[model samples]
Target chain A: MGGRAGLLIAPRILEDVSRGRDIILVTGTNGKTTTSAMLRAGWGGEVAGNDTGANMIQGHVAALCASNASRAVLETDESWMAVVISSLRPRVVVLLNLSRDQLDRANEVRRIALGWRECLAPETYGGVVVANAGDPLVVFAAQEARHVRWVDVPSSWRDDAASCPHCTRAITFGDGGWSCECGFAKPRVFSASVGATLEIGGESFEWGLALPGSFNEVNAALALTALAECGVEVATALTRLRTMTTVQGRYGLRRFGGRTLRLLLAKNPAGTAALLASLDPEDEVWIAINAQLADGRDPSWLYDVDFDNLKGHRVTCLGERRLDLATRLTYAGIDCAVVDEPESLQGEGSVTVVANYTAFREWMGRSTPC
Target chain B: MLRVAVILPDLLGTYGDGGNATVLAARARARGIEVEVVPLAIGAVIAPADLYLLGGGEDGPQRLARDLLVEGGFVERVRDGAHVFAVCAGLQILGTTFSIEGDASYPGLGLVEATTTRARARAVGDMATMVSGHMMVGFENHGGFTSLGTGVEPFGQVLVGRGNDGHVDGYRAGRIWATYAHGPVLAQNPWLADQLLSEVTGESLAPWASVADRLYLERCERVSTRRSAGDRTAGRH
Candidate 1:
């Protein structure tokens, strides 16, 4: 208590997590939504998170408010973590990878890590920090703590933003994760891959999720790692993974009115590339674009995605910014159609509807007609 | 066949909003829809597609993104046809212009011809967004003051939570719909996703998509039931 102070802002959220009830806090620049949802699915603690995909103080608070039990899993935005941790002091906090997020409020990733480190340093012995060892920022933040539980990064760490936390040496990725001549390595290790295995209520499954992407594998692993650290037996955690369900618009699948639709949310270059790369060659697809400030005022990052493989698909660009999305698609030489009303369009082949966080939800909300 | 195009500004990293895109793709595939995701960065080749999506980020990213989208005059071209949808920041970008920090204002895509000014206080909460045109429900979180222009309005009202712009969020200008609620907006409200899909597919809304809606209701009920049960158990404890 000498020269040290701990802050408590959201007391109730942390109180719920500490009572030996299953609890996990997911925070990161990206993948928090999917990762937290996966953590909930993997942990299966009444399953509460920012499923509306809104990660913030109120969103997590609402989840806690709506939570009926002492045990629940929640995802907190990186901005909200310092305050949340101040109060909740969760038993386990899983930090997803960090990237350049909103340029306005918190422009730099270092600021976020610094904030988390400051908050975490005060509570060295309180909660375990389950972080992505592959991410230099996260690893460095963990190093600042007296006690940390670092999770092993998968073999593939894409778009690595590695900078020597000590000597400011640029970290580079080679075979597994990241390395530097400074001897900073992702030291954590684990066996089973998150996406590689599925866990149901009480059974472990060897099947992958319906969605394609290596990121999901990392997300899955993070969830599994967090839950396992929380004391859930790997065998039991494996069962929860098998029966994992898509959180609505995140990766929900459904057949309505004799048509099948796959919904995915793409908001950035990294996520968009992952979305594009995950597309199978055999599937038919339709795309929609929106140009709203909420989607990012620019809509310029589309150039980063490799659209050269966008052959043989009927594309539809819609939204107030449909022209923006359409123009980009057309320039790629992919034939596309413009549908003013996404609901009226009909399809016979495998249909994929891609929208932002909002449009995707809107499209998925329509009543499934008989 | 599935076709997905993302109109990203710059803040795609904030709050994991981009994960919404991946989630939608994964959900659609569960139903056997072949998904093709395309990122329509400004100045890149453009293509018309079935559906359009927008997400929410901070104000600065919105402005930086606004400059990029307007330069290519891409928003105007995309709006002329696509079945479009916009979220918090997306909704703001579609307007004529939006004010950041209540002083510096940037010209939006003008697709909706409205203005969004950052509010003195952010309206962050679990809101009950009434699904008006579409059968949907979701959560909202934002700090922008969105004023619907002469011809624009919101998709729905704040049934039990914060309306579009705090007490004044949510705007609808024809097919262009925008709101402040994120709801993780797709994960909890798949019907909303299908509604947007309907606009793209030119098909009637499917009842099965309501599985998510019904499940949401059932989930609420389950939570309530679980709460009561826990209360009783606690009484014994």
Candidate 2:
């Protein structure tokens, strides 16, 4: 396990799942932890994950070792997917969308994708790939697999992949949800709402995530998909989805000092934007950027956020890389104060802190001292 | 109104590549430039944008994204000097074709005329590169291999961290600058971010001000600063 985080550990733990123990492996850039946790909760299964959100192979192994259950549902890292899948050969694999994450450590997106794709190959003892049908690569790879079952997109989300994986023609999106130009249509529906009514075909139920991002909806759908693949009734899964709790610090609301603070873990371009997109127009913000190796060394992707939604918000910045975060905010025309000191963040209003995963942890550790 | 469009695939584009547009809009507004951002997905109308950004996604997301782009012609339009910046998977999608493993090869946007292959190895952790043009320091964790075609201009030679594709990766076509470094690659290196803006708007930017910023600027001022000033001082002899 060395020094690997829980993200890395979930997969390794799943590798040791005993025979006939249904082990489910879930991996993606984001949503892995959330989807895995949600599925476990929805399925009422004893699950092992980086619910502490460590999300590394070492964390995977540790979580598995710590679990008393025979079945392990893991949130695998794209970096270690192949390595873990080769070792674990889990019963089912659920893959969420891939996005830019830890570029310094992840180098390129394809690198991680290749690792997952190789391990989830069809020839690998008939392993089932429960893939996102909306994503081109996932669907394309599913096409190559022997046992491929696709999960449709939630109603609130948009079909981001718009071309045929075979011919590279534009995929058509209509009331029917998603279809590729090459006649490769998928069963995914693009749904977007603050929350939605999920009809599990047996028992119609409604579940709402406290978070506002459309990405979270996709995460919820991915969770349901994993449950369905596990032979759990859709209604049973949907009914259970309502009783779940949000993972701590992944858009979790907390009371720090006197103000209500929202803690969001953002370490990449897509995640940051998704969090930014979901921000309340009325909330004040405190953005922290970490200089940690895991939080990413570069902060330029901050340039991609649409700060228009945050037209008149008071913003405070923290972290060793505070200037980078501050400057990016400054560049975005948001007036911000750089607090090189972490203690100053206390009593700082109902602030939304969008920081690296480590910065989020440090803030949580400091604000909610054990 | 200055309109910037961010084209994101499912995988790597999630983190905050969209934040780049927000930062640009804020900067443009501070400069009294009107700005608007339009997030474009696969089938959205390909509006002629002033600035185009593609972010990182998983390899499958990149392939799906590349296929989505193959029909849009927007990438070609971006390559025609619409001011394009691509990160991680974004950079991989710009290549002619990217291969995740030996069994599959997905076509790219073909903007930079390069090919990326997912190597049979994982290249993770911090890196110190020696890029050729400007000095940069960023980490690289990738399993892809990027082979730049002829007539391409590299972003820089790796000074201490990994370069374009985490190896000898480089940018090309003079206008477009692609790299594997993330963490909002421009977050710390505002100078390079400015360089990307300059590449698009054809304007020069003011110098960055910070101890690390100044050190990075000084490194940029001296091409061989890493080898000469750092621990390799004697090795430079």
Candidate 3:
């Protein structure tokens, strides 16, 4: 509401508020929240971050208004990148990766990347674009920037980039890099991670981080790359990033119903699949899903998620779209108990509760004493 | 083994429509019919299969898929009585011609006597159609509003949301089944899946019941019953 009123009273309020601040704009399908958190942590103090998951005008305004900080990291929604970029005129724009999520709103991944291309064009803005060298779509969008720092954020999800965005030709993703026949290929190397070694501009940093998932490490990588663009030393960024833990309560352990529950929020196919893939095969998982508007009313994307990741693990399905999820799981030869309560599931040790948007919030509420 | 080829999932499987292949293969295997699901990526040769499934995609990939299908002997195989199930952009790709971004119109496979053009508004949300004596429930998300040519039979009457034109949704002529519903429509409407499986195997499938599907169907009923679920506007993008 404040963001809207500010916009109405003064159309260029976002521009006004963002003026003179060294802003690092993070935009991507996944890892935006975690990356923003990492950026804030890497920058240590005096850095404002919009990590509330809203990522639009409301959250951006609120975050910026709360702080008179000299530096800020604003996580903008992938779809809202165009609007935010024009106003913020950020110093460094960090793109993690691109994939289809919340299809009802952003129907096509290409369209979002296209929007980014338009906003990040040389004529539009001049800033350092730190993007994922692993994702072709990210490469496509970040290609227009004057300065691009490509960081290889290792991701297993590649179903979204089956074809080249530039020529619509089939792209071949080899162990080395991905390339299309139409001269569109992974650009010249900048930085990459080889397991525990984080490579940035011919230099290496320790890969050890306080974050749980490899996805978080990817977030840290992008965040580190963005900080590098902002002239922060690699050693300083790594030390600060490793000291921080937890992101919007993600991977946060909390006791619930006589058991320790680890909360992981995965709202889209890429996110859920990545979460599922990163989990220990023997670990018990409670998969919660919902079709609320924020979660993209269509739960059909659940099919795209490889439940096979949980093949060796005991699984329980719950939440609003549990039936759809359970139905999807049954076909994958994984028999999961569908329970109305996550507490009812027979599990030992720390139970990993993976839920999409509303389900995550609802479960967080349930775990928190009413 | 009955092979269910999910063609160009990378190009056209954005909506999780590949789940339909999983549902089909699993259901078929449970009925004592061995099945193999072949995920056909681009440039892959078209193999013999009992059923070929195509899902929704963006405009560029949709046209690329149509052209690839033409060059990959997909139409010839379909002409030989192979079963094909397509949804949304898949439906558009199998048709005669479809318009995408701007005023640009691209040629389709011409396998189905249909043509898709950009509508004033896109039709989205819960769509229902009474098919095979039951409500075939699914969600429609597409900017293209399809119109069937003469003599082409529609899959069902539009009971909830705007389908093919508004009064109807989808195309069913011989072995090919196409609709605007994005992905996993088969899982939502298991009867439709069974009907397609039965046609492919040339065997009668026994009645199969699933607690999850039953619950899903009940919810689909509840959603369709509510006026808020369907396209309140004439169409939506």
Candidate 4:
């Protein structure tokens, strides 16, 4: 549905559907789907969303057509965010962290960030923007927004954000998060997750999420703040968020070829790092990397991932680019076997499968019992 | 111990180009040669090393890398004796000038007698080439269209995808090698890695059957078979 036909029909459909409904546009490199899911769950109303991860303009049209909800939480791809924002003029746009993802098809991180900065300038975007304060790129892009709600979501991976997007200077990271020597720093976070408690506007809400990792906690905080800006109560949003177990098959336990495995989707280095950080050091893990169109044709970004954290784990590499993963693992001093198939690997208990885009989708398709 | 310095890896080593350094170190270690992989950070003083490597990066970082290298006198050092392996943006920065988008061009280190201008379309796909009678398999993702001078020689001829500017793939002049092929180029071509190591250490390292070699062979077969079956459109970005 990515042809000229879909692009043409999307505008007309969006014009008709978004006439009266409040739209919340969620966009970023990583955590877009999961964060949009959290926002939808905590929206306290019937919300239209692209649950299948179809985040383009066509996807939005299909989603709006599928649901009759007055309020919608749309997950927009970073490259399409500017167009989508101009079309929808969303009530609360959640600008999550921006990082390199699909460099072969997408623009460079700083270029995209610069485009976002131009698109989200105060004169262009009058809506409230919920932005991540810890990521320097996100901070740079969202600072131009007319109204901004900054959330402190400390990033696990900073390689993509090693340099300032504004000045190209090396960014310094400390206990307070990242700051550029060029006078740009993390904004004052209006919403933040301190320990297990989510603090927003001086009010603290305690909740346990089924989604693992501090990244999800950050996602939840950002979503809750966006929901609040959309007039959803913090307590109500928290309750709805607590009920969410998974989004688009992520954090799912599925049986694959007689072995039960927990499926985690990591499309880029930052997401991969977050997924790795969420795992136990000794957990048996299988990484499936594919260089398909959906998974970014170039697997060069794999080198950016700090695989040193997976040193002690029994790791097996699987997928089309399994050899590449194995080669990378070898260089990282991590012992890993390159397996032709996931079933060939000998494991006693439930193994964790961290896969990129296409691989995760393929596994999800295979894991479903007929 | 063989000293290998990866210049400004934090800035220039995007595109998994760090794997080239890793392959060098691992291959050297496998050959009973102790290798020291030194990461020369931005603004660090360039030290004399037997081999120096640089990788690809975005325009901002590439320009920054070129400026730092010029200021630190690393370009002269590389020209003097160091065996250098550069990939994509690294190759561009080593040339006379690199024309980025918006028609803005930045001066390079002038280490290589070539100039890179931003191409009309970026070449992105699986790339194969014949380098020194050896089949080299890798990936190409670059927007620079490079033209070599009369004194410069290409590292290889393009076998599948567009390389350099649809004909040649890389430049090889004396001890320096630069390529747009960056599957960490060395991981997919162990022969080239060994050749570079041999040039640096002045010893012909025996060909050892490594797991990397097995992977390289498999990749070569895959690319060849795929091309034979007329599936040129299968992996192009």
Candidate 5:
């Protein structure tokens, strides 16, 4: 709302708000919201940012206009990273792992990575980049950056990075970490996410936040490293990170239909697969899907998720695309039922509800915290 | 026993083509056929199999997979009476020539008499085609417009969306089946999966349509309705 008014009042709003500010911009496919929230919390002050999962230019304009704080941690959309970097000229840039996401809308993964390589060049961007080394796409994009502090944060979603982003040859993840036959390989790292800790400069700092999932551990590690780049001590950032519980109603336990409902959001295959692995196989989980404008118009990604993880669990499918979910589950040999509403679910356990973008907001709209 | 080799899934599985292998195995196993699915990685040794599946991928990986398959003697194996199923980039990799990154054409394995050039606009939307005397439904997201040579057989005619220049869908010759349809192609059409299985077993298998079948038929109806309603998608010139 503020962005529209700011744009009308002042044509050069983005530049005006971003000028002379210690803005730390974060951009990637997954974990943008949670990682942005983590960096904001680690900042330990009234830092300006889009905490409601809005990472677009309007959101950045609004956040910047709403606060006059010296520091702002903006979560940027991957496609808009170059524009934001050129205008905002942030002191630090966080480049997370890039993967396949929203194919109907954002189709080419390599195209975006290659664009990142161009904008992140030392001549264009004069900021310190805290990037992940394990992800070949991320490493390739950030290689041209002048100052890069690499973090070897491993991601199990390896399907998107099977080929080299540089030479277009097959990338091998053998004894040499990750390398193509043409010598495109992982850069040396300053930090590595070892289980629940972030090891940097031969010392380990525990960043076990209230957030769950190994991806969360990696997020916390990256967030703390980013905070350190902005002159914040590692100890202070880790202490503040522990205080973060839920991000935009995600990772919260709520009361719904006489069951302890755990709300989680996963929009794509990689995110959904990781979220599925975090669930208990013995318990029941509610799977919801919707192909709205925000959720991408294509529902082909439903087939990409590894629903075999729900083999030992009682599963229920709901939402606008419940039938699509049912077909996927039935093919995987997992017993599932389609329901129109959450209360129609046939179970008597604390259900874990994992939903896509729009379905998650719909489910959370009619529920409250336990 | 059925031996299915998913050729270099790591390189060519950008759009859930692994689900095709899974669906093929599940269909065979449900009918009491012992199935062994081998997902061929980059450095993995190429094993002889009754059938091989290739999936859709990006331009660079498509070329890489084409080179590896040539080196692995995959074309020779296919000529030795083995069945092959490919989709999108997989289909292009088996053809005479295919273009990528706009105007960069490369030689394929020459398994099919077809060529692909970078189209003026990409095609990305719901696509349904008629193949094997049955309706097949899947999503088509590609930038290449494949031109089939004379005497090359199309697996199906275009029923709904744009398919190989808006007339046909894919190429089929003997045991080799390639298509632009990619909901794993077989998962959405049980009859095609059965037909492939029957070819290997040398038996006309009975219809074993399940919930996925019902879902597919419903989706086909929905797509047709959307098309009639003037909601047809995919970028065109």
Candidate 6:
């Protein structure tokens, strides 16, 4: 229902319903769903959002139609952000880190950044853009906006942003973060995360989120900033965020085929790197990849991930592109057994299944109450 | 010890093209051949190695890599019989010129007698081709249509999807081989990896089949079947 027909009908639905609502649009290559969920959880007002990960225009319309709430926190796909923003006139736009994701379907990171710059020009979008100063591409985009609240989210994946999006010069990373020779550097951070503590306006608040990984901490920081920009108190936002346990099926433990498995979605190298960092060295890992349309037909991103992190662990590869993942694991010096079905990988132990988009959805659909 | 130099990977390796180098090192080590995988950054001195590899990248970086290689005098090394394996953008950068979007053409290393012009539509999908009687399966996602010169020989003929352009896939001239397939190309096609390794070592290596072989065959069949089904649907229409 949400293909061409949905896209065609979205503008009318948005035009009829989206006015007078305080919309906060979150967008990036990764973490759009999770961050939007976080923003919605923290937002005090009655809010509506596309929490099911349908981030396109049709998804926005469907989500807005489902609720008559005065406030909405919508996860906007990076490509569709401009169109959605033009229609919704979002009060706040949260720009997260931009990296290589689904290269077969999407434009390059720099091209997307250029689009964001044009969309968020002061004459067009006068809203406050909550951006990550850690990502050079985000900085490059948000710099064109009239007002921006820059948050210092740590970026571990620097491969895509190796060259400056502005000058195409090599960006050098030092103690202060990335800076290009062309005079474009990481923007001044308005909010920063330093070892579990979030510093905003020189005041430090310790946040212990239920979500795993430092990336989630960054997401929480972005959410807090966006919430604060929306007139919610920082303390109130933090309390609400703590109550949030899961985004979609991510971070949910489910019983499938007599084995307890935790679902984690890593669609690209950046997300995969963060997941890998969060894992215990001894924990058994299962990685599933699919070349389905939603998942992007190219599995070449498997090489971008530092699979060597799972070197000593027993790994199982599953999905339509299980062989691709298995081959990559072999080259990474990790031995992995390729399984055709998720049931074949079931064992009576705690297993973490890290999957890409469609694979995660497949597993999520099969998940039972734990 | 076989030294494999991966040239400017941070610039040219957007499509997991680094996996090609990884496959080379892994295949070499499996056969008791000691290997060192050297990742050469931009501005770094290029040292002679058993095999040199370059991967695919976006247009801006492709131009940057081409300029850097030219400035670093690495093109002469490729000409002086350095076993080189390049893919997609890497192949384009090695050609005489590559026409990017908006009628902009960038100068290439001219290591291969070919010119790449941006195609109106991008060719992106699973691709299977026959390379020297060997079935090679991988994925191709490129906008550039490379036309080889009359004197140059193609690496393969397309059996399923678009290769190089819509016809021939890659170029194979002496020690240099270039392709558009980046299933890392080597990870899925172990035979091609072995062939490149054999050329580097100056010895014909035996066919070393692993789990990758079965995976390659399965992928080939899947892509072939899908293409045929699409063709049939088109025919019916």
Task: Rank all candidate structures by their DockQ, best first, as comma-separated numbers.
Answer: 6, 3, 4, 5, 2, 1
Docking quality category of candidate 1 according to DockQ thresholds: incorrect
Q: What does candidate 3's lDDT look like per residue over A1-370, in tens digits?
A: 7766777787778888999999999989898888888888888778987777768877788788889999999999888888898999999999988998988777888988889988999998888899898998888998988888888867787888888888889889888688999999988867887788788877887788877778887888888888988888888989988877677778878767666788899988889888887797668888898888899888998888877778878788898778888888888889788887665755347788999999989888777531
Q: Which ten residues in a row have the lowest lDDT in candidate 3 chain A?
A: A341-350
Q: Which ten residues in a row have the lowest lDDT in candidate 5 chain A?
A: A340-349
Candidate 4 docks at the CAPRI level of medium
Q: DockQ values for all predictions?
A: 0.03, 0.28, 0.74, 0.57, 0.55, 0.77
DockQ of 2: 0.28
User: TM-scores of the models, in the given order?
Assistant: 0.55, 0.68, 0.96, 0.95, 0.95, 0.96
Task: Give lDDT tens digits, candidate 5, residues B1-237.
Answer: 789999998788888777788888888888878999998998887889999999988877888898899999999899988899889998899899999876988999998899998888788777887886787888888888889999999989876777777778889977889899877677777778888889877877666767777767877888788778876444443
Looking at model 5, the pairs that clash are: none
Compared with the true structure, what per-residue lDDT tens digits does model 6 show for residues A1-370? 5433655755466756789899999999888988988888888668898888888888888888789899999888888877888899999999988999988889477789888999999988999999999888898899989999999877788898887777677889888587988999988889998888999977889888888888899899998998888888898889888877778888978888878889999888889989998998778888889888888888889898887689788899898888888888877878889888666554588889899999998888887758
Q: Candidate 5 — what's its lDDT?
A: 0.84
> What is the C-alpha local distance difference test score of each model?
0.60, 0.63, 0.84, 0.84, 0.84, 0.85
For B142-218, candidate 3 gives per-residue lDDT tens digits of 88778899999998877777888788888998889987775378888788888889998999999888854675576
TM-score of chain A of 2: 0.83
Provide the clash count, candidate 2: 94
Top candidate on lDDT is 6
Task: For each of the candidates, give the backbone clash count.
Answer: 163, 94, 1, 0, 0, 0
lDDT score for residue A343 of model 4? 53
> Which portions of model 6 miss their true places by more than 4 Å?
A2-12, B230-237
- Model 2 ranges off by over 4 Å: A1-17, A45-50, A54-57, A110-118, A125-129, A146-149, A155-176, A188-195, A208-217, A228-240, A249-255, A346-349, B1-237
Candidate 1, residues A167-236, lDDT tens digits: the string is 4444667666777678887765443354455432344546455445777776776777678777677666
Model 2 chain A: ten consecutive residues of lowest lDDT: A187-196
The segments of candidate 4 whose C-alpha lies over 4 angstroms from its true place after superposition are: A1-10, A343-348, B229-237
lDDT, model 4: 0.84
Q: Tens digit of lDDT per residue, candidate 2, span B22-61?
A: 5565555555657688888655776888778777654555
What would the DockQ be for model 4?
0.57
CA-only RMSD, every prediction: 15.3, 7.0, 2.0, 2.4, 2.1, 2.2
Worst 10 residues of 1 chain A by lDDT: A1-10
